[model samples]
Structures are given as C-alpha cells and as structure tokens.
Target: MANSPHGGILKDLYIRDEPLKATLQAEAETLPHVVLTERQLCDLELILNGGFSPLQGFHTQAEYTSVVTTSRLPSGALWTIPIYLDINRAHLDTLGAVPGSRLTLRDPRDDQPLAIITISDIYTVDRTQEALQVYGTTDEAHPAVHYLRHNTRDTLVGGDVQAVNAPQHYDYVAIRRSPNEVRQLFKKLNWTRVVAFQTRNPMHRAHRELTVRAARMRHANVLIQPVVGLTKPGDIDHFTRVRVYQAIMPKYPNGMAQLSLLPLAMRMGGPREAVWHAIIRKNFGATHFIVGRDHAGPGSNSQGVDFYGPYEAQDLVLKYRDELDIEVVPFQMLTYLPDTDEYQPINEVAEGVKTLNISGTELRRRLKTGAPIPEWFSYPEVVRILREANPPRDHQGFTVFLTGLHASGKESIARALQVALNQEGGRSVSLLLGETIRQELSSELGYTKRERDINVARIGFVAAELTRSGAACIAAPIAPYNEARQQVRKQVARAGGFYLVHVATPLEACIKNDRAGVYARAIAGDIKGFTGIDDVYEAPSNADLVADVTKTSISQIVHEIILLLERDGYIGDR
Candidate 1:
C-alpha cells in the first residue's frame, strides 16, 4: 500500500456533492468575488486535492509566521512553504471585506467560481521578514523575492476555504491526478515502491538515465512527475514541457514507469523546497524521491554567484529523511561519455575519459539556430517537439520596439519597416505607432511616470499576444525608461521574439525634424512634458538594434534591419 498522507491523514476539502456544489456556486455569486492570481489558483488546486494535507486553506498570520521562521506548522508538522491570500488595500473598502465576512475566490482566466473563504484574520504583510527568512535573501534578484516585493498586495487575508470546484483544466485530463487518485493508481499498479522525480524543465536522455538509476537503487518504479504550474520566469511553458514529457515516457522501461502532472507553483527555494517536494511526493504515494544537486535551485544572483551551495538540497532533504517518511535518492550530475556513447554519473567517470555535455544556455542557442541536437544527449523525438514549439528565430513571431525622443524619425522608420516587411511577407505585419497607440490602446493614459509605465505595459501585452499568433509587430513609442522597456522585452520574449531598436538620433536632429511643432512647443513651455526638453529620455545601453536616422537614410536603415532579421533567421535572405 502507498505511504500514509502527510500529517497522517489526507484532507479533502472539496464539496463533492452535486447539490452542495450547485448551492455553493449560487452562494458564490452573492458574495464578494476575489479574483485569484495564478499562484493562488495553484495553491487552491493542491489544497482541495489533499496534496497539501493538513492545511485547509491559506495560512493565518500565526501559521504563516511559524512556517516562514521554523519551516513547520504551529503543530510542528513539516511545511516549508507558506500559502497566503493577498488582497489589494483598495479592494477592502470596495468589497467591505473584514474579519468574519465570507468572500468567493473566482478564477481570473474565466471568472469561474472555485472556492469560498471566510475571513479570519486580515493583517499587514511583513514581506521583508518573509523574504529574508523564507528565501534567505532580501535581494530582489531572486524571482520569488522580486514577486513578493512588488506584485503581492500590502495586506494578507487569512481564512478557511471551502472548495466549490477545482480550477478547470482543458488539457492532459487523464494524467492530471489528484493525490487520492494517484494513490489509488499506485495501488492498482501494485507499485508499493515508487520513486518520484521532480522537475520544472524538459527531460533528456541523461535525465531519463538518472531517474532510472535512482529507481533501481531504491528497487522502485519511477513516477515521471513534472510541474505543470507556474515555474521560474523564463522557463518553457507547461504545454511544450508536457509534450516533451509525453514523448519521453515511451522511452522508459515498460510498466516500470508512469507519467503524472503536478500542478505545483515552485518557489525555487533550494533546500527548503527540496524537503517540501519530497513530502508532496510522499503524499502522492511515492516511497522515494530523487533529489539531485541544486534541486529546485533558482540559478545565480546578479553577481554571478550561485544562490545555494552544491549538494545543499541533497543534504537538507537527507537531514529530514526520517521525518519526511520518504526515502531520498540523491543524484550526482551526469555527462555523456562520447567513447561509450552512454551517459554516466560525472563523479563515477574515470580520470581520463572523453565526455560531452551541453549547457541549457547552449541548447537554447542551438535550438534558435536550428543546430543539430545529438541523439546521445536527447532523443530526436524530444528535440522535434522543442523545435516545433520554438521554431527558428526567422519563422517565429517577433516585435521590433523602437524607443527614442519624439520627432526622432521613429514613426517614419516604423512605417518604413512595416511596409518593407509587408512587401516580403510570410507572417502578418502590424504597426503600433505612438499617436495610433495613444488613440486606440492607451487614450486615457498620460505622460506621468506611472501612467507611462502602464502604457508601455499595455503595449507589451498586445505585442506578446500578436507575437504568439506569429505576427511581425513594429512599435514606435517614446518609451523613455529602460526598466519599462526591459519589462516589455521579458514579457514578449516568452511568447516569441522581441527586438529593441534604439533610434539614436540626437536631440538637435530631432529638433530640426520636428514637423509636428512638438519641439518648438516644448521650448515655448506650451508642452508640459515633451521628451528631450522638459521630460527625460534614458537611452538604451544594450539595445538589439541601434540606428541613427540623421546618419543613415530610411532605405539603408530598413535594409540593415532586414539583414539583421535574415542573419538571425527571423526572415529570409533577399
């Protein structure tokens, strides 16, 4: 039989009765609706399914403090991550939210009612304390820390949640198992000794070999469980990773392995996260778990230093092995031995053997250029899926964002490029010029810093959407701030490509070319915040494409851009 659930019993919080569910759904409409964030939705799914056993809802202040400081619940049960519900201060008055009031949590994607929570405690969030104690960092360089610092609300509302329904999933329904379902499946398969492998990335041959080795050492079946929920910022989307996982499943020894999807929103918390994962897998009926080097690590800091020591996660998981109730199978790094045409654990390899390995960065570079991924490293089928999802840079959708002072010929250049791309078109072309965007997409936005940031963010959202549909978007906005532009780049790059073009035409040249009298008006104080005069324009120090309109003709600049696109495989050579 599978191991007992964490805290000794599985807690199913969902209201499974059809009549009760209908009543709850109807009651939800009358209550104040709280739209759940992506992370909150992930937490709700786990809570309702008993994966997060012993926790019936988001943590109260005392529980959160205990978990953050002690890595345990108030009852002293091992629980490394603190799950909380945050709400904007503005919403408190709007909804009359207060202690003793019940509110409905709705899915942001479709506004579907998922759960109801009766507020027990509403208090200010100690984000700095949470960041330092939990993440071991006050630095914003950490992704989760960054999110905690900015995205989260000022106040946290703690309550007991009553589940109405699970957050709906349209894909991978068969393998997206709840904890109880997985435990039953283990029983059906007679898999008493199962070792779960946790990953947020796509698996390759080395990973396959490593997991198989881990299972063999423990005399267990393998559970290829990959997280389908939110991961680190730049990781591949769950859809593509799921496809890769599906392709890799057949490569596993028949009847010795099974595939399941874990809806875990990983915090990349290194050691604590490793322990957390082991407990979760144990609850899912696994007898053992594979905790490799740097397990759940969040790479490096801004100083190019690793955030956690190598083997840190392994050591921490091993420290709590008995209490965790799941056996820990530690793994060393693996490399491909070219001579043997096989993968071997790096530590076990002989002193003088030829070995090859590809870094994740190198693999991404190869994929971008359509470089061959050898079979020894990864199966061709997996490679094919990755390539299909990420196509060659030339064929993929992209946005060329032009940022500079007003009257710097950005609009002209954007129009010219749009026309040029249209003439050589394979994908749809779009032009989002300054005046046009202000009129159509951001009319109510103003020139203040916050409004400008919002405006640029809106553009980024639109560009990402367009890029996902494989369009070539040309945007010419006087986006003065570097941080806003960087945010846009990060946002759009996840969907397709984003090229930042710095139109480095000087202020004098812009003044001379002011056909719209914008510069003259600013000089006369008629324009309150005209860029290059009253307002500041922080030039990009690291743009993908930089051109000076004064030095190069429009045709030559357009040709240069085309050449760049061709060289990068974003377009065909003409």
Candidate 2:
C-alpha cells in the first residue's frame, strides 16, 4: 500500500484490509459508464496528490446473504430484515447533490464498517428551472406562500442573493460537500446497516407510523430527514413545513431519529426522484431510504403509471443497494382511521370510506385557514409549524459575518476596508478599518490580541448593521480570534464564501513598525499589556496569503491586497 503509485495518502487513507476498490472496479468495471463530475475530478486529483484520503471499508455479503436477527432500533422493530432492492437505474436517482440516495455501497451487519462501491459522478445534469411546476393548488389564502412573503419583510440582512445565489434544480442534484467533510460525516459514523424512510408530506400520524414501523423492521436508527423545499404540483410551502417539523420534533422517539431539511426545486420525475432521494440520503449519512408511488411526480402524468409504483422504487433501491450503501424501507400507503381516531397503515385499516385519505389538495386547504389539525391525522406540533411556514412572497436580507486575522490583510486583501469612504462612494464593498476601531479600545490597556478579537465582534455588530443598510463594508481589526472568526465566517458563508487574509507581519517588524506606538509602549513598559508582548498570536497556517509587511512597503502591501481582492473576484478581475 505504501509503495502504491497514488503516493503517501494511501497510508493515511482508510485502507481496507481487502481492497474493495479492486473488486468494486471489477464488478462495476463494465456497468453503465461512470463519469466524474468537476468536483469529483478535483477530488480524484487531490487523492492522487496525496491531499485527500478515501474512506476504508470492510467487505460484507449482505446482498448475497439474507438478514439474520438483531434488536429493534429506537423505533422498536426487529433489525436486519430482508428489504427489496433495485439493481439498475443509475443506482439511486440523483446525481449532483440533491438529498436522496446518489451512490450506494454495502455495510456490515453491525453497521460499523462500510464498503465503498459506487459514487455520484458526472457534472452534466438537467438545469431546466421551470418555476416549481408542482402538484396541488393553494387554497383561498395560500398560506404557505403568504408565510414566505410575510417573513421575508424587513429582517434587514446583508450579502448578494444573486451573484452568489444559486437556485436548485432536481435533475442536477450534485454532491454538495467536499470529499473530506463527506468522509467525516457520512462514512465515519457507525451506520453501515440501516433503513431509510422518505416523506413528501409533513409529519402526519400515519407518516410517523410508517417510519416507526420501518425502524422496527430493520432494527436500524431512523433518519427522518424530511424534504424541506418545493414539492410536486401544489406542494406545501417549505417554510411552513419546516415550522411544523420543528414543532413535531419531540414526538419522535429521542435518540433513534434525527432530522435534516432538504432544499429542492420540484420536477415531476417521480421514479427518477426516488433514485435521487436515495443518493441524497447517502450523502447525508443514511444507509437506507423510503420510496413509493409517484416518488417525484409533478401533478399526475397522462399515462397514469403514477410516475413509478412503490415497488419500482423498491427495486431501484435494491438493485443499487451496494452503490447506495443504504437500504430502502418501502412502506405501502398509510391511512387514518376515523372510528379509532388514530392513524394506521393501509394494510391494517378496515375496508371502505373509514380509511382516511391524505391529499396535498386537502392538506393545503386545511393549512390555508388557521384550522385545528387533529393528532390522529397529523401530529399537533407539526401543524403549529405549518401555520408559520404557510405563506409566500419576497424575502428580506440575510446575514454576513467576516473572518480572518486583523493584520492578515483579509480586509485589505479584500480591500473590504476602504480608508476613504468618500473615494468612490458608489461601490458596494465598504471598508471597516481595524486601525480606526482600535480607538474604540484605548491603547492604554495595551490590550491582548484576544481582547482585540472580542472587540472585533463587538464591532462586527456595527459591520453587520452597516451591511443591512445596503452597503457591503470592508472591515479590518487586528482580530486574533480563530473561533470568533469561524463564527462570523459561517454566518457569511451562507451568504457567500468568507475572504480571509492573514496579514503575516513578523513580530520583530510589526512591533518595530507600529504606527500606533503600541510596540514602543509595550517595550518601554508604558503599556504593561500589548498583543504580542503580554499575549499570543496563533499564526494562520492556511491563510490566503502571508503579507510580509516586514519586507513590503505600505503601497506595495496595498497593491498585494488589491490583487487578492481581484483574485477572489470580490472586485473586477485585475
């Protein structure tokens, strides 16, 4: 393994005892052509360069052998039961990152070791963005849309929603996170053997019943990762659905289940979506997923094959089960019982009209007005969430936080911190100079760099405020806070990738060159506390640059900063 041509990463990588890749390559070597996406190509390049490591996996024969005995998971069902699997159709339907099963593989019975077999490859995906041609119709008020519209008003946030903004499409569901994060989250956890349940509807009693039953049957933990975006014709507004989800969380058995929201734009690719759904779940750490009739239908197709039957989805899930690494817990339609006033599986319900039918049209009508949703039909908590998310229309601003070292020239590299606001006043990027901010924290204390960081965030509020005012400000403060920087970075990352600049000025020069007289005061004991004198500075290892202020002049420094800004495309390309 060490002598392998791929270089040093093979040793560091999770090397399987019985290299499954060879066998996987053999078994899948002749399968329908496997293409690599740009991201996947990037990952492969990195792997060859010894920058990334592939997850190690153990071999298993679950697909060949039948499931034996195991205790039920938190949902309370026997574990390791037989499940129908489909071996064809691009493994799981989705390719890009849309949250269903994208790639499949095999997991050991204990659910710890995983064998990597398939992956979501290829960059080319359908990009048609016909605005949400969904399945149901909005009621009189259309509360779901109304809810989105209402909350979108005057929240007063910052960042570009268009330039960095990306709208979702179902056909091109790519794997979103990087390979490293994917390995850490998806492969590290002990979930080689599991079952997954999918849902288009919000948490109704019958839905929970199905999931609970599936968990019991597989003796696996249940990942109730719900779809939190647009659905087929007339789908419930995501916001409302999210609210309902938040409300109904407690109803789920504590540890066995967890929730994540999926943001997808609707397309009527039912059977295809079933595949897509499985892959996304695989990306998100689920080893199984549920698929049913009309998995990704828009309204109802004329052929009325219902997109794909529940069983078709089952077959698809199984065929590529190894590629998916997860199992599908296919549940037949669930229904509500009026007499018992409880939800039951369709298999258990008595004949005739007593079987409660759940329809998107009906659900929308009930949600339009603030009607009391019955527990028997749906969990009460989920209903409360529905009310909040049931409206539509425009959006307010979102959040943006800046990270990086104070001197790292992040702001300067970004030129985000303009000294003269009056210069070219029309530009959106405003500069928040840390030089000016230090005045807010008198030099008398000779404040440590950490103290300066706390001050930076305190001032970040001011930056945040300025951003909301429709001006993207460039702020620079000698903020020596890696953690705080991360916090701000995450806030801004949702809006756009944060630009970090570590003004790498050596201590000897930075202090010798101090214009604020901080070094002079610290050296002479005039200031008992100074950043480098009394405190520490954890140099950034992965900084975008090492702006050696020690060797460069201010003009040259600013020029480099401008170049950085141009490189990041924050400003026009130089």
Q: Residues 1-574, candidate 1, lDDT per residue (tens digit)?
A: 2343222467678886899989998899999989999998998889888888878889999899899999999999999989999898799769999899999999999999899999999988688898888888877778889999888888898988998878889999999999888888887887778889988999999999999998788778898999999899889989999999999999988998999999998999999899989888877878888999899989999888888888999999999989888888989999999888888989999999999999999999988888898889899999999998878777789899999888888889999999999999789999988888899988998899888989999899999999988899999999999999999999998888788989999999999998878789889999898778988899999898788988999888888888877877889842
User: Candidate 2's residue-wise lDDT over 112-153, tens digit each?
Assistant: 112223322212211111011111222213222232234212
Give the Cα error of residue 479 in candidate 1, in Å. 6.0
The lDDT for every candidate, in the order shown, is: 0.88, 0.45
The C-alpha TM-scores of every prediction are 0.87, 0.37
Window of ten residues with lowest summed lDDT in model 2: 156-165
Evaluate model 2: give its lDDT.
0.45
